[model samples]
Target: MRRLLQKVLDKSQKAPTQDAPGSTASEITPQVMDGVGTGSEAVDNTQAVGTNPIKISSVQRLGFQNASNSCSHRDLGFTGKIAGKWYAVFGDTLWCAPGVKDPAQDLPGFHGMVRDSVSLLTNDPLTVVDLNLNNDSPVKHQLQFVPFNPAWGETNMYGFGGTSLCETDARSGTGAVYYLVNANDAGLIGAGVAKVVVKSGTPTVTQRYDGTKGHWWDAKTTARYGDVAAYRDERSEYIYLLGHPPSTITGWLAASYVYMARVRATDAFDLTKYQYWWGRQQGWKTKVLNVFTPETAVMWGTGQGQISWNAYYGCYVFVHLAIGGGTVHLRTAPAPAGPWSGDVQVYTAAPIDGGLVYAGVAHPYLDASGKTLVVSFTNNNHIEVIKVAFTK
Candidate 1:
């Protein structure tokens, strides 16, 4: 516990004082609101999205939902290391749904409302936002659960799915944080961004939603490049972003194409500084208009997932979901830009209560050996964890 506390305090000191080269703090005004109240678990909305729930013996279940205080959330389980501690962030959370016992039905007032939350992870169980360390908030010492967007669940104008995070190169003391938030509805309002600044062991988070959203690479429309996963390249002074280009609709399953982009370590928030990977022939393109299209996707057939460097495989591993099917697929590349290997079926997700299982991602920080992985995906209204090991 002392080690965890030290890590949090250490991250506070490393917060950057300014945005990247082209971006400034005064550009977007922040809106600060109180934390969300706790409630009962929620059930899955009626959508025949993915395959039915099937338990596989090889895929070891970690039971993250059973261990946490807030067990009922549709979390992507996108994790990152903060102060050497692994933390998972959830997207659409249910505070108080009508029926807790019934898995098939969602009440009218409910329908799986979204309230984003974060979790602290251990081996067997995961801790939710209710950690009562020491704080003056109304939650009383608990880490506050703030919504990524206050208007997240509002009809078609401003409904959001969730966000993907990356440790930026811009650092002062040690740690730097940034999020590529995809905040849109069925009507296609598209995405935005949020910056999390830690100070003196406490965190200050801010979100911006408007016309000029999505910063550098992505646009504020469904037809633009939206960030799905991000990681800072240890070999280079840049952070590589894995984008899901919704415009490249090869099939009805989802965007079958993915793209790559990078920004300098110090200029993470400067969207204008981002450059897209245009393949080995063309290299990186500085102009957004000349960036990647469907023809230049880093990988195809999977639109959503996460990327991390795997020492075991000696490659950059991309673990993504079969959006239309209930399977988790993986690809490996020498660099973030590819010669990416073809899809390998790592795990098969079994959706509960006729729910669609998607958001297959790997927690790279949890795996010490690249051969064994800690993976997470959403089932119905909750998230589940599993272990996948590859033989040498």
Candidate 2:
């Protein structure tokens, strides 16, 4: 499986990128997910989102350079521990830091302290303490992030709406922020999930399921798309759900495959209780399909990848952005939908002013001895931040 991929990197000093050379597309989207500019424009929402001043400190002291072009990946990301520490719930908000230690004082969830649904309940600056976590502090307000329906078309009052989407896998479970949403439609014809909650702290969404004929891709299903990262596979009590397939509806996601479905981490939002990952009958099937099935590959896929669960090699990790290449791959799989493992490039930085680099993620709670993880990749309003060392 690509030698189980273990390329390390951690020079320990370069780490610093703020990407602001000229920025605009509302400044490369207030936080990320900044859309527009298609028809072979691919992405250039107005360029200038820079920040590769080149200082890594740890991508193994910075040596990878070789990116054999393996290609493979998906996200919003999901993790929740709060009070007990470890927190990071996706583009929706909650990246934490109350009394942290390493990773530079853990500084307001380390480099991406968020809260913006236009700053949730309102204190505004969101929250940040030191290593700049992107600046602006004070607005902590307990914890907030409630937007779910920009009336469905989502004109970015602050983010949410799927574009090149292929998501699923974002959870805090019963406590909320569940996830599995879609935005430009044509997911063959189906896909849905965006729970949110925040237990009293104002998070919202309530519940949404969308599976039966509101179009199950009109019964043709071949994994159209789900939230993009939902690992609750605690040895299979079942919670899987990762997905992809709907970029322009026929790009075939490079070579496609990395579709899955499951329910029962307490019915996970219900949608008839779901279950699909037949892999030609390897297991759970029967979700419909009578028609659309353009993607399926539990491996070698990447439209925008990220399926974390890499507790220092406990397995299941997949970070992506290697199709047109800026490097930044890394795959592994014991499950959570995968046979994965054939893309260990690790890190290579390149798209800052030329404009379009994308979603490569892997935060791993900002690394607490998980041998150092922190990966992030953007480039249109730039964001690059690598520190790899997944060693086992």
Candidate whose TM-score is highest: 1
lDDT of 1 by residue, 1-392 (tens): 21221111111111112222432222322221111112332111111122312222365777645323432445566665544455555555554343342222334464334445555656653334432132332212223233343434443223344444444522432333333444453334434444544444333345343324433223322223434666666667777766555342333323444566677756766556767654443456653423223334555556567777888767777777755747887777777766566567766767787887777767766666776777777777566677876665
Model 2 misplacement above 4 A: 1-43, 46-48, 60-189, 194-208, 211-248, 252-302, 306-319, 324-361, 367-392
Model 1, which residues run further than 4 Å from truth? 1-58, 64-67, 97-115, 125-157, 169-186, 199-203, 207-226, 246-254, 289-294
TM-score of each: 0.68, 0.27
What would you estimate as the lDDT of candidate 2?
0.40
Per-residue error (Å), model 1, residue 338: 1.2
> Candidate 2 lDDT, tens digit per residue, 102-122?
222334323333332211111
| Full-model lDDT for every candidate | 0.50, 0.40
